[model samples]
Structure formats: C-alpha cells, structure tokens
Target: MEHSKLSLARRLKLQQLAIFEKVVETGSILAASRALHMTQPAVSKSVHELEAQFGESLFTRGKRGVKLTEFGVLLQRHAQSLLADLRFLADDVNAWSNGVSGQVVVGVLISASARLLPRAVVRMHETAPNVIVTVRVGSNDVLFPELARGVVDVVVGLLPDNQAEGTSGNLTHVPLYDETLCAVVARDHPLAGDPSIDPHQLENMAWIVPTQESAAWRSADAFFEAAGLVAPKRLVESVSILTNLELLLESSMVALMPHAVAEQFVRSGLLSILPLRLASSFGKVGYTLYAERTPTAATQRLLQTLHEVGESVRLELIANSPSTETR
Candidate 1:
C-alpha cells in the first residue's frame, strides 16, 4: 500500500525541526550533539524521528559525517527560514516586554553612506544604545545578492535605473530621492577654474572609474556616449570613496561623485565641480529589503530613522542643486 505524500509542515514539531537544522549545519549527529549539549543517541533519535514523520531518510551517514537527502535539503531550507522567524518572533515579544535592543546588519552603498547613513546610526545609538548596527559598504551587484541570500538584513543604496519602480518577487526597493552626479577635480587642477567644459574636452583625461560591478560606471559610460564623446580609455578602477576623493585631490584624474557628497569638498576648497552637462544622471538613492521575512524591532526603528534622514538629505539636495530639472 502506498502512503500519503509527506507533509513535515503539517505534522513536524518545531523542536525536532530545529534539531535537524543543527545536525545538517554541523555535518554529523555527534558534532551536533556536542553543540546542542545532547548525547549522540538523543541527536540520532531526533533525526530518526524526522525521517519517520516525513516517511524518508533525512540523512545518509558515512564514517566521517552525513549528507542531506533531497528531501532533507528541501526541508532544511524551509526549516531554517521558519526557525529564523521563530527567533525573530521571540526577540520581538521580548523586546516589547523589555527595552528596545537587538542586532541589525545593513549593506550600504558608499555614496549615501557618507551623508544619510551616519544620521540613521546616530539616531539608533541615541535611542537604543543596546542595538548593535553593522554597516557593510558595497555596490548593488555585491549587496543585492546578500539581501537575497538572507545574509544582509537590509540594503541601502542607489537602485539600478533599469529596475522598475516597485516591489517584485521577494525584493522591495524604495526610492528616497534622486542624487545628481557631478564631475569633480582637485582645486588646483587646470579644469577646476574653467567656467564650462564640453563633454568632448574630457574624453582623453584619466578618470577615477568605479568598479565594473558598480552601477555608477554604467552611468558614467552612458553619459559620455550620449554626448558623442568616447568614454575614457585610461582609467583607474577604485571602490573606496575615500580613495576616490584622495585621488581627485592629489591628481589631475577626474571622478564622478554624488552632488551631495561633492558639495562639501567644493565648499572646503578641496575639490571643484566642473560645469559640464551629464546626459545620464545618477539614479534614485534608496533602500531594498526582503519582503517575505519580518523585520525585527530594531530593524524597524532603524528604518524609521533612515526615512527621517533620507527626507532631510533629499531636501538638502534639492535646495543646493543648481539644476531645476531631474533626469
């Protein structure tokens, strides 16, 4: 007689499910037993229980360790997510009872990080000192993958111009504002004092290019091509914002930067914005989040803080902007 299709979601206990996840993670029941502080027999019993409930073997044990069965891999993914939700649920309930405090990891792109990110971090620290915030700086190519993999809690940066404005699938991108790009150079650079230079004039100059993975490079290339100028053949690919600024400060090399970030340097006598038209503009700077998963209390609070800061930055960009129109 054939048995009914396996449905671990319907009949499995969370405790046993949790134990199975640990076993798969640790690679063997014996190792998992040590991690969980249970005996080897107890760990074995939990795995056996899972297999019996699902009507399949969850693991094929070898002398060295164990490997997940097809069903085991499928179960592990769902179990890990469910267990994570349960953890967030526990943290949420406890936070309501206790004071606000938890950990949040944010992946931030460099341009916005300098202006808005610190404001959000400062607010978080002042309100909830117990909440730990880790910010990893990267481009969309690097950070968006982390968000999809459940490695990053949230991603804050400029979204690609190609992406439609809205949530799609498991990802949600929110537009904060459009940050304009400007070509800048050191205060002493020859073009620094030029009132206006056409795009063709900059064709042969060395450029501080962003990494190929970054979307900024695409904009830079497009802007030059749009103006009938060949994109710079001589370039320095750098990822760090600091390095870009320093290079621009010490050399004749030109770099494209967010107007918000470039504004201060221009005021400080460190850099000068070349009055050149960029046919292509920097896209909207914003944040992306995992829509399916629930955000923790700390995450929610941080997002609220970011929203406040984002608004201020948007206003500042508008007020200080020389151009009245957006691309």
Candidate 2:
C-alpha cells in the first residue's frame, strides 16, 4: 500500500515541518532555537537542510528579523494543517492503545446540559459502544490545569484571556460561540420594566456578582469600571450561574449572566433582563478546551458535539429573541 512507504523522506518531512513551524512562529532563528532549546547553528542547519530538500530558500534575512520567502509562507500554512492532521492521527492511535473501549472523561462548566454531552456520547457509542462517557463540572480555573495534566480530555468553559500566559506550547483553543453578558433580575425588579437602563443606576442596587476569579465576574467588573462606578457594595458572590439565578430569585440582588443561560429564566418570567446598555467590549464568552495537542478522535468528536449543541441553542435564542419576550 502507498501508506506503507513511510521512508526517510517522510520522517525528514515531519521534522522539517516542526522546525519550519517553530521558526515562523518565533520569527527568527535565535528565537526559534531558544524555543526549541537547540543551538542557533543547529536551527540554521535544520532550516538550510529543509531548503536544500525543497531546492529553494524558505526564508530571507531581514533587518528586523528573518522573513518567510513566498515559498516559506505557503509551506508554513500547509505545514500547520499537516501537523494538526498528524496530531489527530497520533491521538487516534493513543485511544486504541489506552483501551479503545472505556470511559472517556469530559470536563464541563456547571451550566452546560447533560443532554448536550450525552448526545455526543450516544453518537460515539453507536460507533464504539463499549466506551463509557463520564463528566466532571468545574470552573475554567479548576479545569485548565487538570486538562493540561491529562486528567480531563477536554474542557468546556470560557477560558480566561490570561490563561494563555504561561501555557508554553501545550494548549489550543477553539471558540464554540460568543455569549453576551446581560443583567439578571426578578421580573418585578425596578430596572426590569425599563426599555434600557443606564449602568450608573445599578450602583445603588444590591448585586449578586460572581467572585473575581470567574470570567463573568471579570466582565462585570469591567462593565462597572467602564461606567466609572465600582461594583455595588452589597454583593453576594457565587461561582455558578445556577447559584446566581437562585440568589436573584430569592432576593432583590441582580446578577450578570450570559444571554443564553439568562434566557431560560427570563422566558419563564422568573427573571427579567435589565435594560442596561452594557459595554460592547465586555469581552467574548465561549467554550475553550485545553489539550496538550490536537484532540483525540473521541475528543474531537465530543468537541464537534459541543459546537453543534451550542450553535443550535444560540440560534434558537437568536431567532426567538428571548430578550424581547414578555413575562
């Protein structure tokens, strides 16, 4: 078979592929060497070897740094795609060795549905029935490290922007959807009836805010900062939207929530969205997965499931315009 011919060319192709990717990423030979922990000479030699193989220079020396030649730019793009495919292949192979038929661990945010995950698991079972699917729920702060350590295969949550700071080269993110933040209050709350409320008016109201560690809370803080007001003094901190909703239901406290989760209660007339003009820069809300490499076959399939579920729910809410629904 053609696949059986995994020769020297193939092996060198993979090596050069990695080197070229790192060089393009770091933007210079010295920087690439530091990242790859190779000497500058070795890095240069590797690049030269690759150019020799292709019978063309992949990069040109420049004053600011090394710039990719046209061929190098083209190769960089294709190499990244090829490397991703190779990583996927490797993950598939690992899945087979690690008991192709067993429980798969999934990490999720507290608000995600069991139904959402089960649909994906069911699809996997149709093809690989022996694989048991298990789930763990936590905030991204708790899950990111676990995912990095291989304790969880994939995580579904809004990854903090700062979470990327020290990840080195071990993490990748695929945004599932953007969730807009909105204020959640009881249907009869003073601000609920208004077409739109100003942020400053909330300064005196009791607030049910997530702790500083949460992405939602951070966004809420940014919102207040943008309004030139501090977060309300009498605040109740909760980690999950479910808890925040409970707090809003039993008290006059208002909470910040993603529009999708807030929609559920708002439609039931249990909660009403405040007509406040929030900062358009409240930052994006989306599902992020932390994987050491590209996701495994099962993990990739699970991610696809998550994307499908999230998109379906988002589209439903958009079409219904839950924000416009009356109690």
Candidate 3:
C-alpha cells in the first residue's frame, strides 16, 4: 500500500517545529534544549519523531553536534516562517482582546519622511486609530539590519538595485513613486536665474553632496557614471536635509536634491531650482518596503496608506509644476 500524505494533526507539533528551528539556528540540540527549558532527551526525541514521520533522517549526528539533512533544511526554512506568523497572530489577537491594537514600527529614509511618511501616518491615524505607528529615520544600511532583526515592520525608500543580496529570506517591495534629481542653488546664484541650464555647466562647480554611503549619493554616483563625467569635487558631505538646504543658501555650492525637496525650498524663495536637463534614463528614485519576513495585517494597512498618500503628493506636485500651463 502507498503511503498517504501527512495530515495537519499528524505533522510536526509546534514544540517539535520550534525545537528543529532552534537546533538549526544554534547548531546543537543541547543548546536548543537549554534555550527552550527542555531536557536534551526530549529535544532529541522531537527531532527523531519528525524524521520518522517524514521517512528520512532529518539530522546527521556529528562530532560538531547535529547538522540538518537536505530534507531537514527544507523543513526548517518553511517551519521558521510558519512559526513567525503564528507568533505575530497570537500577539495581534491578544492585543485585540485587550482592546488595544498592536504597534507597527516603520523605517524611513530622511527624504521620504518630509512628505511621504507624514501623509501616510495621518491616513493610518484616520483609518486605524488604535494601531500605534512608530517611525524611525536613517539610511538603508542602518534600517535594513533593523528590519532583518524584526525591530521594524517595514522600510520605505528607494529599492536597492540588488534586493536579494545580503538578505536571509524573502522581502516584499511595492513601488510607490519615481523621483528625479535636480540641482538646488541659492536664489541669488547665477544658475538660479537661468531659465534652463546645461548639465555640463555644473562640471566645475562646488557640490554639496551626501556621504558616499547614502542612497542619495549612490544614485548621484550612478547618474555621473552614466553621463561619462565624474561628480564635481564635494565641498561638503551632508546627510541632514536641513543642513544641505542651509549650505545651499549660505554658500555658492550647488546641491543635488530630489525635485520634491527642492520644490519646498523654491516655494519659500530661499532656494532656486536650476533647470538642467539630465540624461532621460539617468536615475529613477522610488520607495520600497523591506521586511525580514512577511508583514502583518496592521503593517499591510500602513503600506496601503503610504501608497495612497504618495499618489496624492505626486499629483499635487505635478499640478503645481511651472511646466504645467493653465488652460
């Protein structure tokens, strides 16, 4: 007689699944048992039972402890995700039962917080008042690690060109808007007065650029590389949005900034935008969300709000652009 597929009830128990995951992570059953407050024999029995049910050896006992077999590795991968979801579900249900919503921690780059994040937060408050939203601002290097450790529920910024590298598990990305880089200069600067400035004219000018490690800097580097020109010698490396804007106003240096950010300064007449035509395909900026694993319902709702707010902001910017003419 052929063997039947394992039923939900017959499959590995939560304790067994947890033990397998801990063993795989810690590289030893004894360590896993210690962490879970179970005896070594019990941990060993759980692994043995799972292997018997699957009709294959799940671990290879070795001098270095126990390592997973191919089948064991596969099971561990799926089991880890399952366990995470179950934990999140439990926490969410408990919060709901207590008449308090769970919290969603979000990571955002500084540039995004100005318009994108605030609008999203407002929408979230209006829609899910009980769910608390926490926002943390930093570069991707800082935020991605936090995301991986489950410190933050999601990250919103330009999607790294290579999303798969340096990540352990799958991440979800949703494109919200595309951003373009523009030159920001003080209103009194010569370039600011020009109706349109050529890109080559910026070759010898001093530039206030972001640190080389920042996403903005990377985007700027790619743009320069595509143009067959090196970025102008940096007069200052600034990560703070306010400091960069202030530098443009206090000095003759031109700063590369997103069109939306420049627009804010332009409106106040503190800075002016130079209409320099860059390569049509230079750099496309957009927002992305990264999670160590799948996101929760509350996190999903917040993401939806972000996309909606981004669309609204993009439309408003386009409508107010000088390029647009009244009928």
Candidate 4:
C-alpha cells in the first residue's frame, strides 16, 4: 500500500472516512448509527452524501445486509491505510508535544527493505513506542524528488551518483555503509548447481530489468559494458520488487540485486548468488535529506538508530562479501 497517497489531506476528510468505515463494517446505516451513538437518519445522510461526492454507489443493500460494490472494494485498502494514518496523526497531536511522540515518514529503497530499514525501525520503536512510522519505498529516481519537495523527511538508500558530494545540490548526505551489485537466480536454477557461472551466460537468459534510470539498472549496465558484452536483450521491465522476485523464483530470469538485499534471500536458499564480482562501484549508502530544516526529536532518534544499524551492516558486509568496501 502506498501510504503516502493515503494521507487524508490528499483526498477525503478524516470524519468522512470514519463514517464511511462504520457503514462498511456494520453493513447498514442503522447498525452503524447505533454503534456510533448517533441517529440512524444522520448515518444514512452521511453515507448518501459521501456516495454522491464519490459519484458512485458504494454499497448494495438487501435483506441479508449490505455488500460493497466494486469501487468500494477498491477503496477498502486505501481506507484502512488512510484511517490508520489519521489515528496516528490524532495520537501525535495528543502526545507530549515535544515533537518526540509523533508520526514520521521515511522514504526507503528496495536495497534497504530486507535489512537496514526494518532493523532501524525496530530499534526506533523500542525507544519511542508512541511514535508512528510510515515508510515509502522507491528508487532514487522517485524518492529524491519527494525528499526535495519536503514530502519525505529523509531517504534511506544508496545516494545516486549525480547527487554525490562533489556534484552540486542542497541535499545533505550521511554515508552509513557500502554495498555492491550482485546477480541472483532461482534456487533451483540450472546454474545454481555450479558455484561459479560465466557472466556471458546472462546474455542468453531472460532478465528482470529495473527502470533504466534506477541505480541498480545503471550499475548492471556498467558491469555488462565492462565485461565487453551487451546487457541481456530479453528484458522484463517491472518496478515492483516482489514481482521481480516472483519471476526469478518461477522463471529463468536473472536479476541484479544489491549484495545486502540478496544475501538474506541467498542464505535462506530462496535464491542463489552467481559468484560473479564486478569492478563497477556503487556510491555511498545512507540517508539523504533536503538540509534546509532540522528534523523533529522523533525523526532524529530514528536517524540515530539508522546510523547505528548502518555501522553493524557495514561490518557484517565486510566480513561476508570480500569485494565490498566503504567509501
């Protein structure tokens, strides 16, 4: 779910969502009204008004009760995520008001999904139980713009080469660790039987390609170029991580994944590393911010946890992947 879109400020108001949810849960305006300690007519009017605003019939009522129409089902997931955010906002407003007990939105990347973000989030929660977190995961092509727009407080991922220190920008970066690109295939893949596979074999195989603008894709392109070979011509372009993972699991498609991300899946026997190393280097891996303003106490605490987690991850990578080194 893209919780960023679920922010009530973008669309429906909080009260409307609350009323809409009650009707959905109780199956009828009368039942919802009783549950909410309001009159049945008021509940009915609210539902009718919302349905009119949406310009669609959200429910179908019958003797057996009510059922959601197609549009209603489509909005169900968004509603849940949206309502949760609203409640999170309410909790934040009622907190100590020291800014340490509110919601914080963090933009994440697939590279950090398997390890970095989760570890930092757990540690953050341990200290600030009242703090709520909403993580928005995407490639730098998508996340950095959001960070620049102030929609995201911080981005946790490998800094794109164009945004590096020597390059000009208002963004502030903290390099937490380093990682390298590696190839992965299904556990039961034909090449999985051999610890070492020739890089040229990738040319003949299908590939789950990342967006051309993404750092992962650029890294893979550079790697293939350095090997004096054309990158796999048979490409499946999908920005979704799980979709690519599923394709790798069930098909002959080879995929490029950061060593940190691929390590967990490889260790669990869900995927196999190609045992191929690359000379193409990735830039510093860490959080990037818009630098114009200071983060709240809650967000700063989370950033602190991320730095700590990054140190542990960096040491772990050096001990595990021989070719990886910090910048």
Candidate 5:
C-alpha cells in the first residue's frame, strides 16, 4: 500500500515546534541544541522532519550558521504565537493552582520607561509579588508588532498618532494621560535657564532629534514647523533615551522631550528644560494591547495597577502646571 502525506494539522507536534523555534532564534541547529541541552543531531533531525512535513525548506545552511528561508520566516511567526500561548496557558494554570504568579513581557517606549512603568511595577510588586515582569524598550514601530504578535503582553508609551500610521490596526490603545513636549539643554549649556532664549537662536546650535520614522519625530517636526523653523541643520537622530540624555549632558545639544521625562532629569539636576513650551504637541501616554486577545489574569492586574499609577501621574502633572487646563 502507498502512504499518504499527513496534513500539517495532524503532523504538527509541540516538541517539533519548540525545537524549530529554538533553531530559528539561535540561528543554528547546533547552537539551539546546546541551548536546549539536546544532541545536535537530534535537533537537526527534528528540523529535517518539520521541513519534510511542510514540504518546504526552512533554513539555508551557511558556514556562519543558518538563515531562515522565506517560508521559515512565515512559520516562525506562527510558531512564536503558539509558544506564547503555551506559556500563557502554563502561567494561567499556575495562577489558578498557586496564586497570581506568572510572567509578563512588557514593551515600552522611552517616555513610559522613565516614570510610569517603574511606578506601576513597584505597585504591582507590593500586591502580586509572584508576577514576574520583564520590560523591553523600543520605539512605536518595534513595539506595536510585538504586541500584535503576542510576543509582548502589553505596550506602554506614547500612543501612535493615528491608525493609519506605521502601526498594526488590530491593536487598541488606552489613554492614560496627556503629555506635552519641552525643549531641554544640558545643565551647563549656554542657554540653560535662559528665560529669554529664542527658538531661532537655538537653530544655530546643534540639536538632538528623534529618529525620522518615529511618531515622536513627527510630533517634534510639527512643533518646529509651528515655530516657523526647520529642524536644526546640525542634528543627531536617535531613539535611545540613555544616549540622548548623555549627549545632552556632554554637549551643547538641545532636544525635545516629553514634559514628564524632562522633569525627571530636571529634578536630578542633569538636564534643564528650556522655558519654551509646546502646547499644541500634546501626546497621549498610555498602554496598548491587542484588540481581540483577552488579557491573562496577571496582565489584567498589571493593567489595573497602571491605571491607578496613570491617574496619579495625571494629577501630578496638573498640579505642577501653571495653567489649570488639561493638556
């Protein structure tokens, strides 16, 4: 009798998926085997079996290691989602058995990493101590896809400018608070604490701007345009908050930052906010999640804590502002 090929639905095994995912992640079957504490041949066999079942080559072997084929990339996406679901299931079961104990990977933009995320983590710790939290920081472009793909439980930072922007439309944002932009300089910069400093004069000096593709850059560019000026001729584009902070402290460069982020540095005497305020550039700060996916219990608790922290932050910002009107 002749044999028939098994459908992928019937052929797929969790073990094979796990092995394949590890190979993709490490970029080499041998490296994945080492990481998994399995023999290299065993890993290679599993990958070969997966390729046979799928009727496609998953990786291209190279002297350096391996690279995912086009099909490999596609499979990796679904594999990651499946693995994430497995983790969520394990966490869910553990929570039911022990307590609210699980892990959540959170993606954050620079703004949220400064204050909002830390405060919320501390609050979550006081309550759900067993809920382990991991944070990955990046721009909207990097975090949004991760959120949609289930790699991240939630994302925190400035909400995207619009649904049509460079973000997944399936994700939904919850506005926590509003934040405006403020120009900042090194504490010893020539314009530091100069109440009469003009935006036009700052143009002659070097400036640090967000990366061109980020939502922050769009808002910042609009801010400069509103002031009837182009971005400074001498500009350094970056998305790294730490690098930006260091650059501001070490040079005469001026940068625009979220008001809340600037206040933290200002309080520490590391950076000084320029007297200029960008009222029209108010951006919403909040957390985002996939619209269709139901959040695990641990994620729900974290979200609740974030809301509480957000309210406190909103109140604090209102109290500090000279104008009573909310941004």
Candidate 6:
C-alpha cells in the first residue's frame, strides 16, 4: 500500500493539479483552457490524466459546463490550499534572499477595519516597509471560509462565540481585547445630546440592525429584551458599516456600533454615541487563522503588529469609553 501511494505520488504532477484547479474554478474545460492560455485538447488531457490516477470521476460533463462530483469537491478544497501555500512559499523564498518583502492578505470585519487594521498597517510600514499588505473587508460568513481555504492569511475582528458552522473546527482564534457595543446616531440627531436615554423611545425610531446570523444580532436582541423594549419595526437589517454610516447621516436611524468604530467617527464630529449604553454586550476582538497552516514570515510580522496595536486600542477604549467597566 505504501509503494502504491509512492507510485501514485510520482505520477501526479503540479501542472496537472494546476489545470484541474483552473477547471474547477472556471466550471468549464474550455474556459479553463482559455484562462490558462492552453489548447482545449491539452487542458482536457491533463484533467483526464488526473482522473485516471485517482480512479474516480472528478467532474460530470454537461453541454453547458461541468459540475463537480463529491470526489471533485473534496479534491478542489485540498487543491486550493496547496496552490495558495505554494504561492506563499515562493514569496517567502524571495523575501529571504532579498530584504523583508512579501504579501499578507487580511480579512477584516467592520470593528477591526476602522481602527485596528489600519493602525497595524501603519506600524508594519515602520518596520517591514516592503511587505505588501492587502485588506479584504467582509463579514464572518465570507471571511471564515476564506481563512479555512487558505485564501486569507488572517482575520481580525470579533471572534466567533464557540460556533463553528462553516469552518468545521479548524480555526484558531487569538483574543486581543474586548470592546463594548454602543448605540450611535448622527451628530445632529434629536437623541444625540440627551443626558438620559429611555429604551422605549428608541423602539419607534427606524433602526439599523445586523442580520440574524451574526453574533452582534444575538447580543443586540438580548440587550433590547433586557431593557424591556420590543424589537423596532421600522428597520433596515444590514451589517455594512459604510451603508449604516450613510443611512445614519442621511436619516435618523440608530445603529449598534462597536466602541472602537464609534469613537473614530465621534472624534470627527460625524456621529454621536447615544447615552443609552449596552453595558453587557461586548465583542471580544481578535485575529483568527487556520490551525493547521504555518504562516509565512510576512504574516507573522503583521500578527505581531496587530497585537501591539490591539493593546493600544484596548487601553484607549478603556480610558475613553467609561461603559466598558460594566462588561
């Protein structure tokens, strides 16, 4: 059995795997051939060789395109990881021979993107100026799967609350600090300067709330219930920070925002934190990575920077936002 494994490994080639991956991505052998700049017959031949070695059909053919069978779906997952690692390997080697220069792709949610990540990037430039930092902004639903698939080096935001829905228990979350969620509105809103807030007053106002699947939504729901308020009916359900900001500025919609995010806009005089505080609802902000993957040096440097910036942000939030004492 060991000999068979070795023989099969010898027969399989990286080019063949690359072709197979492109086919999976494009969903059509002809599209893969065009993308790879190879002849249609050549691309088909490589895929056939891969299928022969595996002894199972990877894709089922149809006139429009091809669809992955169960085996194909499994292989595609591993194939993507392998290719991403190879790219990182090349970058690592190049950086080693030269000065520090490589790419680190980070997935950031709204909480971290507003302050933590930008601060870290600036700090990283002070040390590893040549390191290329790319940021992909999205929610956990989009970022977590990318982290598992090795498409993102790290994710910086609120850590999941023991819920491993899409990741299948392969992620490692490193807690950096905790920040409270605050009720926010445009600086000129009627509730902006109120010294005392009433929970019932907010129920009639149009509000911006997170989608039900998010951790923030769960916390918000609980906070509202504890305050003896019914869920607002005049609602816009969204998790987009930019969209929420625009809606808040243009209309009188209130949003539950992380303290770190709210503080930045508050200083700029664009938004105000309502006196109504969610003292118990705090998000544990951190970075997450795939447990099995070894981060390249560039990624490790960025992680260290995140830790430094995270500490500073944590301290700043405590000194500035008084409501955190309750959390």
CA-lDDT, candidates in order: 0.79, 0.67, 0.71, 0.75, 0.83, 0.84
Per-model TM-score, in order, reads 0.70, 0.57, 0.62, 0.68, 0.90, 0.81
Clashing pairs in 3: none
Per model, how many backbone clashes are there?
0, 2, 0, 0, 0, 0
TM-score of 1: 0.70
CA deviation > 4 Å runs, candidate 2:
1-102, 110-131, 162-168, 279-282, 285-294, 313-327
> Distance (Å) between predicted and true CA of 187, model 6?
3.4
Query: Could you give candidate 2's per-residue lDDT for residues 1-327 as a string of tens digits?
Result: 132245535646687788888999889999999999999998999899988766778989997779999988777766766675665566577667863554456777633533345555666676666655678777777777666655577766555663432343566665554555667798877667887567777788888766777666677777677667786888887766567767787888878766666667767778987766543233433445554455666676666667777677657655545355442
Tens digit per residue, CA lDDT, model 6, 107-179: 9987787899999999988988989888888788899898888878999888877333244478888878887
Cα error of candidate 6 at position 308, Å: 1.3
Local error of candidate 3 at residue 262 (angstroms): 2.2
Query: lDDT of model 3 at residue 304?
Result: 79
lDDT of 1 by residue, 1-327 (tens): 344436545677889988898898899998999999999999899889878876888899899899999989888877766775676676587678765777777998866777777888898788888887888888887777667665578898777774555887788888787887777899999988887677778888998866777877787676666668776788898868889988887789998787777876877889888777553567788888888877788888888988898899999888766454221
Error of 4 at 326 (Å): 21
* The best candidate in terms of TM-score: 5
The total of clashing pairs for model 4 equals: 0
The TM-score, computed over Cα atoms with residue i paired to residue i, of candidate 4 is 0.68
lDDT of 1: 0.79
Residues 1-327, candidate 5, lDDT per residue (tens digit)? 333446565778989999999998888988999999999999999999989877889999999899999999998999989998998898788788876789889999877888899999999989889999989988878888888888999999888873322335688788888877777898888788576656687778788887888778887887788666777889899878899999998888888887788778888889887765446464788888898788888888899999999999888777655244221
Q: lDDT tens digits, residues 135-211, model 4?
A: 89888877777666555678888777634543237678777887777677899988876755567877788887667
TM-score of 6: 0.81
Which candidate's lDDT is highest? 6
**Residue 169 in model 1: shift from native, Å?**
1.7
Predicted candidate 3 versus true structure: per-residue lDDT over 213-245, tens digit per residue: 886777777666655567677468876788887
Cα error, residue 254 of model 4, in Å, equals 0.7
Q: After superposition, how far is residue 235 of candidate 5 from its true place, in Å?
A: 0.6
